[model samples]
Target: MTEQRVAIVTGAAQGIGAAIARELAADGHKVVVADLNLEGASAVAQEIDGVAKLLDISDEAAVARVVGEVVDEFGRIDILVNNAGLVPFTPWEKLDFAEWKRVFDVNVNGLYLMTKSAGDVMAQGGYGRIVNIASNTFVAGTPNCAHYVATKGAYIGFTRALAGEIGKHGITINAVAPGIIASEGVLSGPHADGFDYVVPMQAFARRGVPSDIGPAVAFLASEKASWITGQTLVVDGGHTRN
Candidate 1:
């Protein structure tokens, strides 16, 4: 039997993050639904018999507190899923420095904070599974998202480099690049408009939903993927197979 592991999934309040949380919970893992929406997180956590934590990933103090609390309660963090991020659709001309910085602040800087804090604990335990949610846009290329794509590109690079440093401690870090997923946020956001243009390009010929990305993340967080590290698994219905 696989040992029960403690997992902290950020941005797990709704959409793709919530789906990932449910998958991990169903795998018999003790999941902590950490998100900006405490109520939503609480709902998911309650349904899964897990826990909920209100967090703003970009805030250093909040990240530190959440990590500290998790370690204190669980004694060790076996998994850390960096799923919280901002996906802004800004044309090159409309994009400005402040907007770019905000995107990086959450997508990149917040991810760093979560990783470093959780990775430090994982290192001490000599085992861990760190899965970052990147984007297939970096590989296949997308328009009106220069800033978002840049951050995801950095995420892939970060995963590769961090693997080299953490492998000695039996910790594996990997990236999951999901294609255009039709989540609540996506359907309500500007990206929804592009579905007509984007869905046909995908080999699946249908809109990829949040659940489609969950199993991929759950597998990466499991012991089955122990030998894998520093790899990018694109889960987009073969949208951008790599």
Candidate 2:
């Protein structure tokens, strides 16, 4: 039997992150549910028969510590899913500098910290798959979250640029840009009211759920997508097709 790959999924306490964790676990990988919510993370870990980690990806020390702990326990990290981010829905007029900075701190800086830390371990192993969660708002130019859109645009750019450097090490870094996913965060926030208006805009009339995104991430993290790197797979129900 092939050995199970060790995967660390950030923001896996709920919503799309939790769904991704479930999919990875179902793939027979040893998944680590890493999130700030200890209770939620632990619940997901128990369901997957995996480990739970209290991680704040924006904190440099916390990022290092979690990576170190994963390395110590698993000896190598095979996959990293950068799914933790702040989704602020403030319009340009109400968008203050503090809110913008806060969003960037998690969406961009946290992404960088996790990528660097996990990537170092993957380099040592000479094999890794890094999938970043991005948003289609960058493409659609969705209003009322300019900061969020900017961060996701940076993620797509980062994925493309970093893939060149990491591919030499047998690592593939790609991104998944979701559109109008009805995740817990969105359901409880401002986007909940917009979906009725948003669904009709999609190639498919139905709204997207967390499960809709999980399989995409699993495929990208799998051996099947080996040749595909530096690409952004937009899972927006064909909403932004070229």
Global lDDT of each model?
0.93, 0.94
Q: Give the TM-score comparing model 1 with the true structure, all chains together.
A: 0.98
Worst 10 residues of 1 by lDDT: 233-242
> Which 10-residue window of candidate 2 scores lowest in summed lDDT?
233-242
Residue pairs with backbone overlap in model 2: none
Provide backbone clash counts, one per model. Answer: 0, 0
Across 7-108, the per-residue lDDT of candidate 1 in tens digits comes to: 999999899999999999999999999999999999999999889999999999999999999989989999999999888989999999999999999999
Candidate 1 versus truth, CA RMSD in Å, comes to 0.9
Provide the clash count, candidate 1: 0
Off by over 4 Å in 1: none
